[model samples]
Target: MAAKKNILLIIADDLGRNLGVCGESKIKTPNLDDLAAQGTYFDMAFASTASCSGSRSVIQSGLHTHETGQLGLLRGFQGLHYFTTFDHVETSPKVFNSLGYLTGIINKVHVGPAECYPWRVREESSTRDVAWTAQRSAAFFERAKEEDKPFFLTVGYIDPHRDLTRGGFGNTQDYPGVEHLPYDPKDVTIPFFLSDVPEVRQELAEYYSAVWRMDQGVGMLLQELHRAGLDESTLVMFTSDNGPPFVNSKSTLYDAGVRLPMIIRTPGCTPGIVNPNLVSFIDILPTFLNWAGFANVKGNRKGRSVLSIMSETSPLDDWGQVFGSHTFHELTAYYPTRYMRTKRFKYHRNVAWQLDFPFPGDLYGAVSWEGMRNAEPAMIGKRPVANYIKRGPEELFDLENDPEEVHNLANDPEYNETLLDMRKALEAWQLETEDPWFFRDGISTRVIFNHIDAGMKMPDRWDFDVNSPGSKDGAIMPHSFKEVRGRGAM
Candidate 1:
């Protein structure tokens, strides 16, 4: 058998399909572009959630937030959102380390309990300082070479996340070996998820600059890999934890939040192939396991390895829809949502639709939000202010025509069958995954733990009526009640 391959996993923070490889013309990501040229690019890769910590937890444990019990940030200081991984779960580093590989992580260390990820080399540096991070990685590479062991190194870049100061994506910093390629607000491409406002443009420009810095870091790492004579033997994978840190895109269940960029260069595999097979971050652990030659794959893992389809340029028939679950981003940003997305259609079931969705701290205070917050009726993106804050119980979008997700077809009778089928599939996935937030009337099944023995059976359909059993009183159902369970809903 061929010698076990070394794995270099580079995870960018808060980046979506904004790289040069993904056809973002304005932003410069040449290193990633080159990586794509020398590897396989996944056109439809997705993150389980849009939150940084929660998404990283999903990536690490190969389980959704619901399964892993990591609903939000690991900030115990605030008290409520201090969630962590389940003790029983095996993280990526743990699994790789078990296979006799020397594992290391440089830059941001968001997901942790420390015990779960027992990386041999843990260098937490500022991801904004790409040159510095690359230097640390180069040293790690050299050490791995000297150790004569297959290594699993994760380079987590903090670039592209919202900066502490509003409208700054690390452009003001002075990195010795990095070029400050700040984008012009006039040249930046405004995503449909955001409104065409000057503030949005300015923030995007900074975000682009940060991304450029990250690209430089990627180049440095690749150069180091080549210098160590490990280029051909290393399996280099580049991806991000979540989407952009913009409001309506990061925390929301829309495609802008979950759809991500994924480029993987496997040793001796076909180069420069753009594969369209639907893939998820959950599949990453299994892929790593497969690479490490693990025979008995763990049973608790929820994803299939895409090793077979990595080389093939065509999409697979079996690669159907992907599912996602999000409980919260922060303690107060509690919006339990579940979704199932196919190539043509997308369905979302917002469990806590009655409660107005809370914003992430960074986004709330961003320059991008200035237009939305002060605009007439508090606008967010292109949607109505009220619609943006308060979501409907169910959302169905025809992605074939409305890729931007501007139009909601949940109420339209024309696509009733599509809505019903997608909803059914989403529900089936919920049951399969044992998602706890899949409760009727938005009454969290977790809360019913005390009442389960008292004949409080989990209802198939939630009763939106305030007077009904388990129904949350004084809560407004955003959508019309015509398609509810007893009315005409599937």
Candidate 2:
């Protein structure tokens, strides 16, 4: 005879594991620390994509970014809506609204096409006023009580994110209630991927200030839930959209970009368990579905519910790998990349490797980038400026040996078998996901299915070889996209 459980999902924009719980950050996130102390802190949770809208859409849809059609930013810095979630997609808000729950989103509605989300109380804005957001959340809880229905509320806090420029992270505004916890540039912890330069530290200090502000928002949002007397019956989760809004972290497919901090507080679960299970952002919607008593009725979602393993403290054999896709960040930042990350290895298949990787508009304008650009020979963290810019088509990294992913083992003869095995495994995943980026000879094989069926001979190589292109005899015919997409073939 238990009451129906409510769900509160708080998404922090452009955040990383720079908190007290991670024990790696100099930034003090007391509220998050308190939450992790009473919740399951996932050690290996990852984002489906490193871009904002792509990752958030995966979170809401329980599908990969490629499947959701939310390929990049729905709203850019200039207030333009570009890549939105398709109308055909069944997002979490739509799903919960279809059920009996009252769904509402306050602050930062990154995923869009209003018809697709169908939020009952959608007040989407980028106001950095934490107090106002908390006030709205309190009103939402009261309204849900008045309507006599269980609720699902998403409080999107835009903090720790880069401002319109890179000079500061959303830290210029003054608020009446939130405390001003300014970080000293010298004391902040420098990310391993990014640099140890003074300019990066200055930006990190500003980023820490923004994080403090965002932590205040979390503290405020949770206070409202407690004041509403809905504490014990609510499943609260705190996480970020992607990684930190830095050069190498935000829009890239490396571990610094995709690996994120995840903390979930579920009712009736034992508190303070540090779970090491490899979870994906896509798993969140399925977790919500399982929480709403609809686990048996899942559709084409690609993730399993993490609710069953919230208390686990060690990595499970089955949950040892994750996959990701990143095609765009803004409307113009197009560099199609897909990856398969196992427990110890990561394989990146950059389809458009010919084009130099694009920078996010905001990151490009940041003061940090300016400093790096002016350096005698610019570099990003441990990587050289040239290495970070122009990349090879395939990259394989043994994460255990090279945690920074600076060393590419794709071409190394010592790991030839490992390289081949990873490539085949990644291709199989691309087949399973029906990714259009599956290429052969510089062309997407998905689009050439008809020509392939018409008996046009093609090379078996991933990319077209200029030295010896013709493969009339050795060409291995691949299955059609229709067959593979329908789960009929692999």
Candidate 3:
């Protein structure tokens, strides 16, 4: 048998199909471009969820976001009752650790609220400093070499995730020469829903700068691997946790929120191949396990191994449908939205309330960390909130025609059959995965406040109405009708 391959999975935060290899001309991602040239790139790959916690949950568990019950980004929510990626359940990493592989994680390893199991070793560190990503990753590899064990190393980079409250690139200075890149707001393409204002353009520029910095980090790590004589033996994979962080991107069920860039480089394996088959983030766990030769690690992981597809030995019939969803954010009760994507189309089903501001009354959405405080005053009233509350119960898009998801065709009489077929498939998947939202009660609630009170008098026009489902007061209430469940307490 061939010597066991070492696995290195590198994840970038909030990345999309906007890389140079993906035909994006404005951004500079040469490092990733080179990696894609040497590896197999999946053009239709998608994240199981849009937010950090949700997508990470899928990566660790090999289960859909609904299956893990971690559909939202909140630290604590109703989804905790189910199994997680790190749980001692059948699909835990212990299966691989038991097989004599040393598994270690660096940077953001948000694998749910479950306490760390005894199987895997984790080197926790702050990834805010982009320079440390490669350095720390190299350190982990050196440790693995000393132990003389084949390893699975996961490196998480927080770059390109929206910058801190300042709005500039977080670690761009570390990747010198990034500033020299063409910073043209005109080159930035705003999403269909968001206005193409100067503020949005400036935000895109900063976002591109961060992407350039992350590419530098990748180059640094690849150099270290090659220097240590591990490049040929290591199976390196580069991907993103979710899509870009924008108004209709991260939290929505649209393609912009879930589609990710996935590249895998294996020695003596196929190179420079692009597979347009549908692949989900949930497949990562099983793919890693299968590649490590632990085909039956523990339980039945939900994903199929893409190794066959990567090698070009398997036919296209082996590929299957992919699903994604989202639940919580800020302190608002955004309705749960689930998605089912095939090769040519994507269907989004909005369960619970169909509010316009999906996460209404959530303080975080209003406060754009970069010192911009709810600049749009028109979004603070009842009509807007109510309108958001009554949005589409279902939405469908033809990827070939409307890749940007500009129009919703679920209600169109011509495509009723397609909508029904997708909905049926979505319902079946939810039922099989045992999603909690399928059994939940009435719509979730979120309480908005007029003014935060640090140490001053409450707002004079404070309004309170229990029956209205949403309130504007000094304190924001949880979305639950009975009582707020987890974490967010007034």
Candidate 4:
């Protein structure tokens, strides 16, 4: 029998397709660049969903976002309706564990009901003494060496997301004078919210700094693997959960939200090959299973192994379309948007919110109903007013021309046929996935506000207080006082 390949999956949070290896000279990703040189780089790779939890769910289950229903961050008093990666498949760790391979996870594994530990996965960190990424990963590799068993390890890094205020590094205040990369702020184009400003530029610089720090962590893990003499046998895959946290990127269905950098390195496999074929995040699960010599594992996984493509045995002819979607963000708001991406064009459909009240802007919240407020122009109502007063119900962008998605071609007379085709495609996908939106109770604007109010009470450790005054439904903003703590109803 062939020796099982040791799998090391390293995932960076909110990393976009911006990297030195991807021909972007702005960012410094030497480790990733080197990995791409040794293995295959999937140029048009995309996440199943844009949000972290949603993307993670799809990656683990080998299912699409609509199929999994693990859309939003918080369940919003809905009590966690989404099916997670853990809820679907035999857990990734369990698969390796069953194979007698030492399996472990380091750092953020946010999936499924937080209160219930279904898979019995072990945590390498505690509240008081949180384990650093490199340290815990090195420890796992050491144990793998001692046991003489092939290992499947996942190291999750929380960097370049949104500095620590909302579960991020939160030390951007300290990292002053870090030079911004070559991507000009004026040309730092995105779909929605926030025009280029000094504050935005500074935030970008901090994000890059965090990326650099994450690279150090990767270096440490690689060094340890080299010392253990496992580098030759290990299959190292480096990727991110989703795109950068810029407006329409992180939580929406744009390319910036779904498109991610993926580098896979197998010692005996091909090197420095850039595969432009479209691939989904779900494909990782099957690829890993096949690499481990376990191709018949049972589950309702929806991805095919890309190992053939990686090995240069399969032709890189037109890969099929990749899909992405978004259901919920933060606590409030449920915008169900599905996307269909072929090599040339990308189509988006916002089924729930036909009139864009405040997309991208709503990410941080326009008013301070809860302790949530974004400093962006859209939130401040300072953006140039549009004639439509809202975005269209559906959107189609010719990615070949409008790579940044600055133009909406859905209503164009010339592209009417293309638009109809995409709509049918998206509808077919929704039906095939059996999406909850197809048969769920309507989600009202009021309910969304209530959830946001509830989230304010238990903001993540990194969140800052949004003290701005604003009203919801013309009602006075709720006050937070020491004596009235936990008294207000959500």
Cand. 3 TM to true fold = 0.79
Give residue 166's lDDT in candidate 4 (0 to 100).
30
Q: Which candidate number has the best TM-score?
A: 2
Predicted candidate 2 versus true structure: per-residue lDDT over 16-75, tens digit per residue: 888788776578788998999998999888998998888889988988878888988997
Misplaced by over 4 Å in model 3 are 74-92, 114-120, 171-182, 191-194, 311-315, 318-320, 330-333, 359-390, 439-490
lDDT of 3 at 362: 21
User: Taking the tens digit of each residue's C-alpha lDDT, what string does model 4 give over 1-490?
Assistant: 6675898988887788767787766667787788788899988888877777778767666777666656666332345444443343455665667777787777767666543223333453312112256656677778877777888887777666564243233333432323323334344332233344444554555566667666656777787788778888888998998877755467767777788899888878778888878889878988888888888885777678888788552336556687777777654546777788988788876656444533433234312211112333233112333512355667888988877665789889998999988877876665555444431123322223444354432222111235632233233224222332343432
What are the TM-scores, per candidate, against the unseen true structure?
0.91, 0.95, 0.79, 0.76
Ranking by TM-score: 2, 1, 3, 4
lDDT of 2 at 455: 70
- Pick by lDDT: 1 or 2, better one: 2
Ranking by lDDT: 2, 1, 3, 4
Q: Rate the local accuracy (lDDT) of all candidates.
A: 0.81, 0.86, 0.67, 0.64
Candidate 3 lDDT over residue span 254-318, tens digit each: 77778879999988777788887888887888888888877776464678778878855233755
Residue runs of model 4 more than 4 Å from their true location after superposition:
74-89, 114-121, 124-131, 164-169, 172-194, 311-318, 355-389, 439-490
Poorest 10 consecutive residues of model 3 by lDDT?
Answer: 444-453
Task: Give the Å shift of residue 281 in candidate 4.
Answer: 0.6
* Residue 340 lDDT, candidate 4, scale 0-100: 89
Residue-pair clashes per prediction, in order, are 1, 4, 6, 5
